[model samples]
Target: MTVTADRFDDALRAGPRVVLQTPEGVPLVMTLASVGERAYAFTIDCLFAAIGLLALLFLSLLTQFAGSSLFGAVFVLAFFLLRNGWFLAHELRSGRTPGKRRAALRVVDARGGPLEPLAVVVRNLTREVEVFVPLVLLANPDFVLDQGPGLVRAVGVVWVAGFALVPFFDKKRRRIGDLLAGTLVVREPRHALQADLVAGAADGEDSRGEPAFEPAQLAHYGVYELQVLEKVLREEPTRSLVLDAVAEKVMRRIGWTGDPREFGGARPFLAAFYRAQRARLEHDLALGRARQSKTAATERGSRPSTMHRNSQ
Candidate 1:
């Protein structure tokens, strides 16, 4: 019943530890943005909205458009665009609004894939209902307790409280919109991680000879296990004891045969294994059968073989 790291391998999958798995199956670990962080990002976005509103105001003044019916219609349209379209346009195009990017956060699917249009629209539109409307109603002096209907003001208070409180109760710190839309907000991964993993593994002396793994050997484990091996190999080569022990553990897990001592050295065995696994992952990706974690792989296996490779 024990869950191992290989149990789930969607690298870009969001969690407390954000793991961004590339198309080639390399994983870059990241951290999830906190609720406080999310608030800061939102505040930054509000600043952008404010600036947009100011621009519209300036345009109205210069064009003598203020106080005219035409200006009122234009103002409403601009508000809708700056309020709703701002989030929709930015999230759909790049998965990050200006606020999110400044906060080093990006939105992704719960399963660690790219954001889809439906999800983007749902989350942002819901924000209007859950956040904007209630705030505007409550904050407007015309709608205050002494000036407006008691029932309406009371309803506004309750609506804001409920929606704003949902995130605090969820384990993932998900807002109501995020829960409904199946989305998560997480920190962006460091840019250098990919280069470090690939570049270090590519040093000529590390994996000098051509890999000699058989098809069966390569099939025993998928990208998840290969990533674990990569981490081990990337450790200091002079730490022979650690390398040997990790290599032996990996071999046992994958049912790899032959003595480590006979394969030049533990480091070489690891390097060659990495080469084979990476090559296999690349081939599988090209075949449109990209490697998934144990759970996804099992689910995939249960489906009919006639299913196309791209479906995986």
Candidate 2:
């Protein structure tokens, strides 16, 4: 448990992190996006809104009989849609609006799960109060000072300040929209192939030795376990005791009652197992067999062939 906690802490410190546990009990750490990144994304969104408004203005000019009131109504509707609906549409589709894509950010549930359409809608709709209302009030000082009474101006100022200050007080930098919607803006986590961990080998032998585990020994774990094992190897390859424990766990899981010294050491055994599992998964993928996580594979009603068997 201490080791698990340490890994979690290390992952969080390595980047901004949202920690979630996989069904197999592995901690999946998703990187949280920085405030600066979110601000940049918002700025990009505002630019898109500006471009949309300009197009609407041009269209209004092109129409001969479109009166000022008609133009005003159309422009307001367009602005509202661009401001709010844009996020709603894009987030629901890919969890990324154009701005978020450009900034390498994505909206997900607070637990780092997939984004829900309802959450996206709620967060974006609340932006009217959290963002635009304050912006509009600040932009048009004359209306507040002259046209609107003192109480109205004061209320606008307070509303703006209160929402703006909410993030400063929250640990995750959650604003009113995020708090209400239970969402998070996080840096998009990219999965890179860990070639370095399995790079060096002779014709088929790892640097330490030839492959120790036979096909049957490698059959007990699937891709998700391989991914976690690969992470452990990459992060702490030299930690022999840690590797031995992992090896023992796998041996028990697969009913392999071999001596620990059979593979020279746990690290080599794990490396050989990793290579085999990776190759199997790649082969399945090439054959158009969709292998998601182990849980997903089970849920899809297709048991994994080759070396992937249900683990204990």
Candidate 3:
């Protein structure tokens, strides 16, 4: 069965599906995904960056103890430059979103092609202006030079006020930078089971089979099980509960007697199923494009024949 892009979008908006692209070219959809894990990872990275910056500052101060102000300034400049460069490179190569979700998030154009390098650069660069007020004031004393003392004090007040209003004004919890980047931060499911179900249904396949089991039948399984089996596909223990005893219970509830072990130990099964479903969808999409191309060519070829007949 072929899942259309509209259906995929609907699932994402509805919060039951995370659409991921394989290292290959297939799009895998899964359910039970969340942004929490990714958010946590980003927090860790931020902590690392903070520690590194502090270490750099300490080293610069130590060098200045020898009365080499020039060397200290040079070192500081180089440190900041390298840090920003690395950040841009990493964000472009992976994506602007931080954490494990970075692995599952697929960057694509409106036409569904891979994202262009220029687009990534423009978006990340815009962060400079969006995050300008806070970043400049925090790091550089020069930011206060142009204004009178009174104006400088007012600017500080405004900055504090703006920072305070951030959470209230932004619906997505984006800071000022995220708003200017024209980027979206979405959570990816730990697994692709939900994506597979929706994609399979779109393609005219029955995911859970005939006579869909009632929600109560899923009682033996916890929320994590449903989430892991349907949402995020990561192998973390917290997200692997579905593949444990919970999965077997779900299978049993559905009247399946096949050994749970036969499904390649849960995680692999979920991954493989999503991969297969994505491949099938892509294959179908390609065939459709091919048919459209052939039809257009035939019409062009027949145009000359019609013209000749009319001229005669």
Worst 10 residues of 3 by lDDT: 303-312
Clashes of 1: 4
User: Of models 2 and 3, which has the larger TM-score?
Assistant: 2
Q: Tell me the lDDT of candidate 1.
A: 0.71
Better of 1 and 3 by lDDT: 1
Clashes of each: 4, 2, 20
Name the lDDT of candidate 3: 0.45
Tens-digit lDDT string for candidate 3 (44-84)? 54565667667766886786643677766866776666445
| Residue 144's lDDT in candidate 1 | 34
lDDT of 2: 0.70
Residue 61, candidate 3: alpha-carbon lDDT: 77
C-alpha lDDT of all candidate models, in order: 0.71, 0.70, 0.45
lDDT of 1 by residue, 185-288 (tens): 88885555454444544566554454467777777665555665665666446456767776777677668787766656777777777777778887988887
Which regions of candidate 1 deviate over 4 angstroms? Answer: 1-15, 18-29, 141-156, 191-312
If scored against the real structure, what TM-score would every candidate get? 0.52, 0.54, 0.39
